[model samples]
Target: MPRSLPPLNAVKAFECAGRHQSLSAAAAELGVTHGAISRQVKILEDWLGTGLFIREGRGIELTVDGRQFLKEATKLLDGLALAAERLSGGPKSRVLRINAPQTFTMRWLIPRLSAFSVAHPGIEVRLSASIEPIDKITGHFDLAIRRGAMGADSTPFLSETCVPVASPDLLKTTPVSRVTDLTAHTLLHAESVADLWQRWLDLAGYRKLQGKAQLRFEPLYHSLQAAIDGAGIAMGPSALVATDIMAGRLVALFPDLPLPLDDFHFFVPPGAATRHVRVFQRWLLDMGLAQSPRPP
Candidate 1:
């Protein structure tokens, strides 16, 4: 709503000229003549009441005002291009909304989303962060990956094991030469299941951690991060945390294993299953099996 305005073609000319810092170069890129580029810049300068370009031989350079406008103009055109591409790409994906705890989102699923996207390019997977357990029946989620018991009718995709892990740095400085030594250091607790740490401790026959205040975490993934950062040791679902543990980011606290908990299940809602969901289910379970750690 100012006094005057110039054509968009002039702004395009200014942005190209600023980027290449040459009118002849801008003309080459825009597939126009040097005279056309110069005329456009003149129109822009007339509108803004500024000297935008400097004549130097057969080329040109942007003035301070042209440089400033070029920054904003380039951004607008780039955004417009992206919008056009997405809109022209066709119908939006029918999203497969998923709900998972924040820790899992950060430490696990978020990292693997790129692989999932590569495997399933057509379907969009939307993740919702929820600490509370999700009920797939009434909810909009197509599937859920959760650490709880599931009925035979449920648990569609995969089942995974649990394993104990800590950082190598923790072992070097601390006096953790044996299983009994764990009693001295702080142990991470998945407080959601009051007996999770206690059970793992018992299975490994480690007694020192018996009454110590275990560092409680609502989500197991948080405890895993703490363990990796050398905060404390946490037992985690091996299927989920295996990649990191195997990569040596977090070390397996014990070589002796415990029974894998078949409790955690990936479930798709009954009657809502589709060909795409079935394909995703197969790929995920295969990936989990492929990711299992070697025995000591």
Candidate 2:
């Protein structure tokens, strides 16, 4: 039986367009005109019988279906690229794909990533940021990092202590010398870990504490940035906010009541740990150990 397939050219165009969320960017990457990319995407949408993207003013956003399709398409394209590389006996350039939480990647891993690149220039790291837990993440990854109890195929490298953090300027405006003082200021919450503030407050024996105002942000990175900007107080894990604290952009409050969170575990699937992956794992473990704790 002959296999039925959508136009391969259209698929490639749609995949590139979807990945960048920009038709012009996709056109540039694929060495085609913007109209060519748009037509190809339209062909894909028609073939799939669904609207892949919703056009916004001067921009485009992926629909739920679009997001799902992009994940599968990306996986398929990555597999094909790898197969082609192997078949063609291409230059031996190691590409290591890593999946990690968005906020953690921004606030921690990225800052330390350059050192790894300097140490091993031969291996290229392609990082994908997602809010999903490592096990729940889609698509291909050589390894994944998440905060949780250790798993059979994972290694626990670092644990973080949580504390309330506020910008120095905000602290000057509304001092939080005591645990209850947090209630006097707006509480910035990361929707991903909505209960972090409550948990820390409970640990400090203030179970009924509520802030003057609450502002929730999707992805922990935004909340941390809000805290740095003096918008409000936020729950800061030592691993994520140590640099901010050291830079004097934010200050940790009530240091005596530190709430220890789960250790960050890195998962390496069976047979996926190549030499480059092993090197990355060693560098990660070393970085975790060498990281300095937030100052008292």
Candidate 3:
């Protein structure tokens, strides 16, 4: 006997609406209007000859039937997605999407991405850089790299330490033999690391010292570039500016006063881990460990 089924579109509408418990949210997720979701859900309810949702205060709630149906619908959708992926030449050929902050992506990850591509030629990587927080449920990214305290769902990747850095040219032109000499030079600030200078000063026992000229930038990378261009002294994260320091582009100031900062973490959406995701995760961890500063 042929299995009787409702309209696939209607089923999809119901599934998404049921999961979110809001027709508007479902519409947004499906890239449709609220009326479209409502109409499709109504069609599904009519086809089944039952009420799947109950009208509530400015929203809808899934009925008992809706909850049960949602479980089966979700399973069916997952199976369909898996089948499609398998039929499309499996996971190796799939694209992996990653979201990260702009500064980190530009100054740290982008430089090392060629190695990842060379290692995993079969998996194409798409990187998006933004400072906005990602919604785990609605975001399209497979993985996200964030800086801050690690949450329960995040995996710790790298810790950060900040030190004052200046272009070699700037340091030469404005030589400083002591920490207080910074008062004679410009101070570069990255809005992202707003309190870095203050933290460093507090640690260096120079609580009253101030910059002769202060320059502020919205992004950390901008401040780093300014420091490299001999504009001013900027507090730099070791992980992001180590290559510059080693390459003689920037010189670390008061190396003995390194200020510890927040760590970096990786987060994945809730679901079974794909082989490609696992591979990328391992590669990221390995690269982080390699780039991290080694103790003396």
Backbone collisions counted per model? 0, 0, 0
Badly placed stretches (over 4 Å) of model 3 are 1-92, 293-296
TM-score of 2: 0.67
How high a TM-score does candidate 3 get?
A: 0.68
Candidate 2 vs 3: which has more TM-score: 3
Q: State the lDDT of candidate 1 residue by residue for 21-67, as single tens digits.
A: 65754565566787898899889889889998777776566777777
Task: Give the per-residue Cα lDDT of candidate 3 at 289.
Answer: 73
Q: Which pairs of residues collide in model 3? A: none
lDDT of 3 by residue, 66-114 (tens): 9999989878876887687779887556588988999999988999999
> TM-score of each candidate?
0.60, 0.67, 0.68
> Which numbered prediction scores highest in TM-score against the true structure?
3
> Which candidate gets the maximum lDDT versus the true structure?
3
Model 1 C-alpha lDDT versus the unseen true structure: 0.67
Model 2 lDDT per residue over 1-296, tens place:
99878788988888767765667656655667879988998999999899999988756789999999888987887677668756988546699999888888999999988988887776899999875755565448888888884344466677788998899999887777777787799999998998898899889999998999999998888999999999999999999999999999989988888998988878666447555775687688778877843221
Order the numbered candidates by lDDT, best leading. Answer: 3, 2, 1
Q: Determine which window of 10 residues in candidate 2 has minimal summed lDDT.
A: 149-158
**Ranking 1 against 2 by lDDT, winner:** 2
Model 2, position 86, has a per-residue lDDT of 66
